[model samples]
Target: MRYSSITDRLADLGSEKWALHIRARQMQASGTDVIQLTIGEPDMPTDPLLIAEAQRAMNAGRYRYSNGRGEPSVVNALTARYTRRRADVTAENVLCFPGTQTALFAVMLGLVEAGDGVLVGDPLYATYDGVIQSTGAHRVTVPLKPEHGFHMQAADLEKAITPKCRVLLLNTPHNPTGAVLTADEIKAIGDICRKHDLWIVCDEVYEELIFNGPFASPFDDPELAERTVVVSSISKSHAAPGFRSGWAVGPVEFASRLLPVSETMLFGVQPFIADMTAYALTHDIGTSAAMRTSYKTRADLIVEGLSNVPGIVPLPPEAGMFTLIDVAGTGLTGEAFAWMLLEQEHVAVMPGSSFGVEAASFVRVSLTVPDTVIQEACARITKLAIRLLTPKERRA
Candidate 1:
């Protein structure tokens, strides 16, 4: 049997991060003390209230397929949350999915056609490149510079826009880099997208994980609300990745168009999970606040520790669960550094090249690990850097 061209394409998009994670797990199983900083999932436990809500729903035998759009309860809860954040959003604008990745794939397939250009930030979430490629769309890269806090500038967007560019995929409190867009930057980028008549997919899965300052959404600008589709999930915020629940909020017409695509792909999210996610969103679980505080402390510790290490420049992450450390000073490519670290110190991290070429000199370290574990990992990294940076003859 032969597979379709799309299936063949999917093979090339295999995630380097997950591959490293798997290798680390295998090593750990074999008695290796591997400190994992590869995957982005929160190490925090899921909120007990959310767990109770789901268990209660299941116990009531509410396991039937939900409405294709979403359970009314979940949609209403999302609408209310968005309404508080942006007054323009209503129930009609919300569509639920099993996960943000699926929501992103559905939106790309629904809106983009073959050969259409999708402008995305370089060093973005690695999975996005695969999503764009699988949709038969071209990915137009706009490099995010460390000097700019790794945020995309409007000028760069304008320069990257071509006649074929039909969409702009934006990730705030971005993956790998932890660069959160400011209100002014969001509005400016929105203006650029509006000028080019590009559809905007704003991945705000890390919306609740902000540290340095307040978060600004593209939807904050009323004019962009109609053009922007906000993709978010309970995975990062509520520490509920196992639930696989997320949502897309946009214009009613857009939601209507995306509904069939979502239905065809997932049929509908599990009813019990939807009910629990609704409860999680509506009720105060105190989980997000706690995760935020914990991650901030972790990020600060890692940053300070790495700063003191020779040949490593750790960028202080403003938000999200990871930080990109420039390892060029060690005279090693990101991939080589990651491999060496794993082999020498048993610390598994993602190579920056996995994100994009622009980050080839860096490696991303996850902040999801415990403080003690992070400290140990930093110590190992410091030792490795010192060893690598020292003159061979002098060390001998």
Candidate 2:
């Protein structure tokens, strides 16, 4: 049977991170001791308090379909949190989804039409490309340069925008690069969007994982509140990817338009999960703080270890759990280096080409492993680098 063109559009949706993850799992199943750093999932287990709260909710028989927008408590908690950050947010402006991925996709589909241009920075999360493609929209890229600390500038945005462009997708504390935008940078970008009359889909899922000072959001500016849809989740912050709960905050009209799309996508988040998530949002849970501290330590270890290695250059991460390493000096493409590292050293990492053509000379390493594992991975990488670079006649 022939499928719709949408199926063809999704042909490239499989991400290299997940591909490496599956390969690593297959190797491990075959008894190989692989140190997998390809995926960004936290190595730590879910917080016990969250687990207990979930259990309590289930025991109380809270299983039922909730309002498609969200349960009142979850909505209220999110509303209060965002309102505290920026005075324009309220419960009516929030919409919950199964995950931030879905929230982002829904927002894109709701706002952008076929042939419309969605401007995104290059070296972006792999899924963004697929999401934009699935909507039959154009994925226009603004090149992010390393000299500028990988932050997107308003000047670049102005240059990238065109008559067809309708949306600007921004990710702070960015995945793969770990580049966080400053408040001033966000304001500049927002100003550009305002001039172009473009909507901003701010992916702040890694907001809580920042190593720097306080997290900054475009919504912090009330003027941009009408044009911005903020997508976030506890997947990274609380280490609860399996729960698949996330939310989007925007102007009331924008959120109301997104709700119907969300409803058609997945009625609502599971009620029991919603209850636990609401509790998590409202309370001062210490899990996120603890995880942040641990991730910072791990980031330091890996950065320092890779710095001593000869061929690879590890960029120091400002926030988020992954670091991008320039692998061009090794005389290998990111894909070739990733495969060689996995096969020869039993260490897995994501090829930078998975993100964008601009990142083809790089590879992303996740700091999800423990300190010892990170140390060992670095050692293996260094040894492999030496072997690959050594002259054959010198070996004897």
**What's each prediction's clash count?**
0, 0
Q: Candidate 2 has what TM-score?
A: 0.97
After superposition, which runs of candidate 2 have C-alpha atoms over 4 Å from their true positions?
Answer: 15-17, 392-396
- The global Cα lDDT (0 to 1) of model 2 is 0.87
lDDT of 2 by residue, 217-287 (tens): 78888889889889998888888999999998998999887888999998888877888888888888877
Scored by Cα lDDT, where does model 1 land? 0.89
Residues forming the 10-long window of minimal summed lDDT in candidate 1: 387-396
lDDT for residue 15 in candidate 1, whole number 0-100? 52
Error of 1 at 335 (Å): 0.4
Off by over 4 Å in 1: 392-396
> Candidate 1 at 318: error in angstroms?
0.6
Tens-digit per-residue lDDT, 1-396, candidate 1: 988778776776875446777788899999998999998888889988899999999999879978999999899999999999888778889999998988898989988977899999998898998889888887999999988989999999899998999999999989989999999999899989888899999999999889868999887778887788899999999999989999999989999988888899988899999999999888888888988888889888888889977789999888889988999999999999998999899999998988999999999999898999999999999989988876873365
State each model's CA lDDT, in order. Answer: 0.89, 0.87
